[model samples]
Target chain A: MKRDLALLLGILLALLAALLLWALHATLALEPGPRLAELASARLEQTGVSNPVTAVLLNYRAYDTLLELAVLLAALLGIWSLGPAPAGYQRSGPALAALVDWIVPLAILAGGYMLWVGGHAPGGAFQAGALLGAAGVILRLSGEPSAGLPGEPAQRWLVVLGAGVFALVGGGLLASGFGFLTYPPGQAKWLILLIESAATVAIGVTLTAAYVGGRPGSGTAHNGTGQSRTVQR
Target chain B: MADLLILPVLVPLLGGLLATALPVRSALVGTLAALATSLSGLSITLLVWLHGDLGTVLGGWGVPLGIGLSADGLSAALLAMASLVALAISIYAGSYFAGSAQARHFWPLWLLLWSALNGVFLAADLFNLYVMLELLGLSAAALGALTGKREAIAANLRYLLVGLLGSLTYLLGVALLYTAYGTLDIGLLGERLGPTPIAATALALMVSGLALKTALFPLHFWLPPAHANAPAPVSAALSALVVKASFYLILRLWTELFAPITDIGAATLLGLLGAGAVLWGSWRALRAQRLKLLAAYSTVAQIGYLFLFFPLLASLPPGTARDDLFAACVLMALTHGFAKAGFFLAAGLVQQKAGHDRISELGGVAQRMPATTFSIALAGSALVGLPPSGSFIGKWVLMRGAFETGQWWWLPVTVLGTLLAAAYVFRVLSRAFGLEPTPLQFVTNARTEIPALLLAFASVALLGLAAGPVWAVLGFGAAPA
Candidate 1:
């Protein structure tokens, strides 16, 4: 009875929240996005940045993008620094290899298409990255660590690409003639496309680096006991 | 200016990232990360003081597009106190985790907690602030339960539930406001919100939810055990910073979101709860025999000083001689923040040194460690509102204003709380000085005393700093002085 009551209450609360959200949308007279956002978003059309959402995520909301990239970097560093369960590495396969082979190429193709289609519609670099990351995770589960920690220079370059590139663009915009991240009046779409492409590459690699940092025997071993966080998972 | 504003978050986050990435132990990296974060926070706060309001736009974002972070006089003062307290606690935590195998879990959560703290301070948007608050609540709960004992787990579970409930309530209110006004940006919301029923209800829900999290007297049932049962460094962090952050939000949101809903009855109700918290917390603290429990209860008392700002809101309205109430509350929060962290650190040291923290058995313990005693006494002095401590200056201004404004009732409550604080603070100190027949030989580090001393000295110096800058940054409808 108690369990059922809790379930019922939770559902009620969720429904109420949904109703509230609907009412809010109705009352706030919520419009499509905003004119400025729409105007800025149009930059994707000219730039040819494969993924529009990725372009928006990486360029339009680049500040948050930079931070999110940092979070990914932090996660990777967390695995490396904390050291992990010794020999926690395992590669699993069954009929899985055959299935994975069939899915992997299709995923990549879909991801690439999504990346290309993002300019005109909802797809973009982030969706491509997610699909790519999913492939990486599957690969890791199949024995490979999914990515390699390159030389210090490569690592440093990759890590700073998001913030560094954003800064360079904004600084250049201000330094040249436009304000900040502003294009040459008519070339907003092309400039935005450039920024988005770089952002996608930077975000993808950084996230991969962070994700791979969690594997066993990579550096997490004998890392002091201070880095653990038990989320009751 | 942007560098200063962003460093507080950047250093910790970078340190946290590095700590995770470093080939060394994650726990050690976390401590180093915390140390780096505190040092950065300290320098940033100092920079804010020197440069004037430190403002930064993330990826150069601003207004409605990108996020903006500003550290004015008020944030600088509070942040200075917070960072110093966090730094000392971090050092104490160093000794704490060295022997424990569980250190790895400590750094990530600690770093995350630090990140959340920085996030709250630097957040410029309402939704961003909500996200940071949620992060803070989650990290604090995880930290609380790190000990994994049944009681600790239970305490942490309760804390997590309460925290999530509070956040949900706050979110619910925010959603209502968004429905009513169509924006989640604080600056935008303020301009949009006027004398509307929706706005009034939103403020009520937000404040009540915040008050629950702040552990204001009626809603303070969850704090004592949660703080008391956690590991010492964790305890210090939770009691000194976690609860206060929620209050800081309340104060910030009060000025930003609820400025228009200036209700007299509501103000009195909040003040009444605050006054009750003072008497109730101090009373319970006096009864607690366990040193840490006693210190934990004292936190409840300190929290009351924050709410005194509500009632005095009118007296300190614009075009006035800065209602001394505002100064009083900020002073009280800052003083409590430092002195309480010091007290917890010292209490932890005592527990470590004596094998237990029995107040009665602490006799003659002070003779062997004068530095620790000096720390406790100094921290206690601040708690008692004695001269040469920040709380003294805060209470002095508050008392002066209370009488001058002819609201004499608050004066008694302030003095009463001061007396009660003195009683409890001195009680522990006096016990430490006892000439008992037996002296326990528990192991303690000489370095342990430093964190407590740092906190004590900070509280002492804060008393001497000029207040003009402090109020200027509060900027609660007032322009920078």
Candidate 2:
């Protein structure tokens, strides 16, 4: 009876929300120009990217993207702090292991291509990074030790590399009196490409590390004091 | 000049990243970074207070086209409060987590959370605010679960989900506003907003979302467990600063964007809910068995007091009385920020010493730590609105405004909540006065005990006696009387 009551109430709330949304839709007046896109286009030359989205992500509103990377790193840090990685899955059979060996290198190549393409085309750091993360997932599924990633210390450095690089570039610009992330017109392209490349590698590592679901080995293997308590209810 | 405005957000981001990347496990680097971040933030606050509001358009793009950071009186007040409270918590945490494995995890996340708090206070663009809010929420949730206990993880999982829900709801509101207004800057949206169904619905979505994040009344269920179960410094930050960020946003949106569309009826409804929160939260706090849980519930009651000012502010005409009400609201919120951080830090010490926080078993344990006990006493007195504390002045102005507006009903609720606050505070204090050996020194473990004592002292002495500067800093011309 309680479940039925809750269901009924939930449906009623949904209907009410739909009604309100319909009323809102009827009254909203969308402006003629796509304002952000137009702004991006007007400043595209100075931003040094042929693609408007890349210009926006890397140049125009780079602060948001910087903080977004911090969010991803924070999630990975949270996972690692919980405990060391669970022991690797039972080693994959011969067929699966053989397949993984071929797939991993191709994924890395594809990630690099995507990273390079993001400067003038439809791809960007996040897309490239997702590809690399997929490779790590593939390796993990094949029961590879360390998930084809670095040790814990190297993993920590790699995870923080994207945000670290972004901040350095921004601060360097600020120090040079052009303000944060404000690349000069001629240098904008190279600077953005550099940041994006760094970002691609860092995001790829972070996402894969997050997927591994715990701290990397070798760092915590010897320090018993560092081990997080097993969660006991 | 723009560098000054941006540095508060930038320093912490850099510091956090460096702290995470560096192999140095000592807490010195993180503590110094936190110190620099707080000092930079304080300089910004001082500049804004002295020179009036300052705004900077990033990347040399003007408003409506690029993101900007702004510091008005509201931002300045909250920024100052966050800086002071965060610095104290940082110091407390440095000592509390010393030699623990979690120290490495604690510092970076804490700095990131500070960066997000400053970002939320200073962000001028709506979407930028959303990004900052997400960073704040994610870091806060992660920090909350750092204890790695089952209940901590469970509670903070719920917190994370609730935070995500709030952000999505707020983003939908921003979308609707952008759909109508052609811009996402708060100033431009304010100029374009009108009394329409879309605007009203957007208001509801955004406020409801913030209400959830702020833990207002009926939506406050997730706060207690999430707050009380975290490590002490994390709990201090969660209650004292994280929730206040959302409340600050709600206040900003209400005054800046929704002012033209708002009605008295809506204000009264919010005030009514505030009354409910005060009564319900305080009652629960009184009945709470654990020290941290009581502190958590007290936070709920304190938030209710903040909401109570809205209806009174809405009803009165634009003049000194209303301005006094507004200033009082800000003052009270700041006082609670300092007092609550002190309370939680001290409670953590008590819990650490006793191995548990069961209120019934805290008799000899609390009395042993004289310095921490004194810190709790001062914080509790401030919480209960005793004379010479900031809340006393704030409640005086608030109640006067209620009477002047002929909304006399809120007064009784305020009085009851105050009484309940006193009861719970005394319940803990009563334990301290029980038969036990007296300590030889008042300042024990100066590193941890001093932060709590200093914060509690500031809430009562600095805020109470020197509140005139707060009025002046907020750019109000003179006292309302």
Provide C-alpha RMSD values for all models, in order: 6.1, 2.6
Local error of candidate 2 at B268, Å?
A: 1.3
Give the DockQ (2 decimals) of all models.
0.14, 0.56
Q: Weakest 10 consecutive residues, lDDT, candidate 1 chain B?
A: B472-481
- Point out where model 2 deviates above 4 Å: A28-34, A219-233, B437-443
Q: DockQ for candidate 1, please give it.
A: 0.14
- TM-scores (chain A) of the candidates: 0.61, 0.89
Runs in model 1 lying further than 4 Å from the true structure? A1-56, A65-93, A100-120, A123-233, B2-4, B23-56, B59-61, B99-109, B148-150, B179-183, B319-321, B364-367, B399-416, B437-446, B464-481
- Candidate 2 backbone collisions, by pair: none
CAPRI quality level assigned to candidate 1 from its DockQ score: incorrect
lDDT of each: 0.68, 0.87
